[model samples]
Target: MKNNKPKYNSIIDAAVQVIAENGYHASQVSKIAKKAGVADGTIYLYFKNKEDILISLFQQKMGQFTEKIEHEIASKQNAKDKLLSMISMHFKQLAADHQLAIVTQLELRQSNKDLRLKINDVLKGYLAIIDDIVEEGQQDGTFRSDLDLRLVRQMIFGTLDETVTNWVMKEQKYDLMKQSKEVHELLVFGLSGNTHP
Candidate 1:
């Protein structure tokens, strides 16, 4: 498929930077091609259109994001540490890439309904990581076994997602990574309860 070719990846990377810098609506195929060091027509060989480029970019980046998080959490023996690692990785990765932050938190949200659904499809892998941690925690007693798994997953993802969105909105004036531990504490032990783990 297109994923195997170097130009495909170059185009995806270029699209991220172009979309982040120009805003998705303002970004043109030629601009992406220029940034990618390829001809404009070359893009069509890899992607069907600008929207396809955007979706592909999310798939490529989120794929790497999920893989790194999985590896980082694999080293930990407990679900608490694994969950913390996931949070840290989520914050740290976005914090390290400002352009990517803009593209993900701002530009990506502006996509149309069908595009949004496609983007959501790309998110399934990351969500699965959260599901595994929650299920493991519940099974091992590190988290409240009585908690609803689906609700817990939504809560965890929503909290992390909103935290990053707020950070992005603030122009990253504060340290995103610093908030990880506190967020972890809140998710693990909840607002009012005995700390577990």
Candidate 2:
């Protein structure tokens, strides 16, 4: 497919930078094309419109993000360690890339309903990674068997998401990666069945 081509990759990367810098509405196809070092018409060859470019950019980056987390979690022996690794990497990745942080936490949220739906569809793959970890924890007694899988997945995803969004909103004033351990501990404790304070 067109996505497999090198120019498509360039366009996607360019879109990320352009949209991050210009905001989605302010970004023009011409600007993206220029940034990509390709002709304006060439962008059309791979993407239907600016919206398509935005969606594709998210898919590409989020796909890579999920894969990296999956690989990092794979090396850990237990669900708890996997969860910690996922949390740490998620924070580190976003903190390391401020442009990506703005695009994902702010620009991406400004899309219309239909576009947001498509973005959510792309998010399912990343959610599946969390699902696997939650299920593993339940089976291995690391997490409460009584807990709902879907809810736990949401909690984990939402906690990580809100933490990053908060950092972005604060203009990255503090160390985002430093909270990974505390967040991981909070999430793990929530997943546990114990009633102790």
Model 2 TM-score relative to the real fold: 0.95
Query: Between which residue pairs do clashes occur in model 2?
Result: none
Model 2 accuracy (lDDT, Cα): 0.91
Clashing pairs in 1: none
Task: Pick out the ten consecutive residues of candidate 2 with the lowest summed lDDT.
Answer: 188-197
lDDT of 1 by residue, 60-124 (tens): 99999999999999999988889999999999999999899899998999638999899989999
Model 2 regions lying over 4 Å from their true place: 194-197
The residue-level lDDT of candidate 2 at 52 comes to 93
lDDT of 2 by residue, 1-197 (tens): 88998899999989889998999999999999999999999999999999999888899899999999998998999988999999999998899999889999999996399999999999999999899988998899888899888888888999999999999999999999999988988888899855431
Q: What is the C-alpha lDDT of each candidate?
A: 0.89, 0.91
Per-model root-mean-square deviation over C-alphas: 1.6, 1.6
User: Can you tell me which runs of candidate 1 are displaced by over 4 Å?
Assistant: 195-197
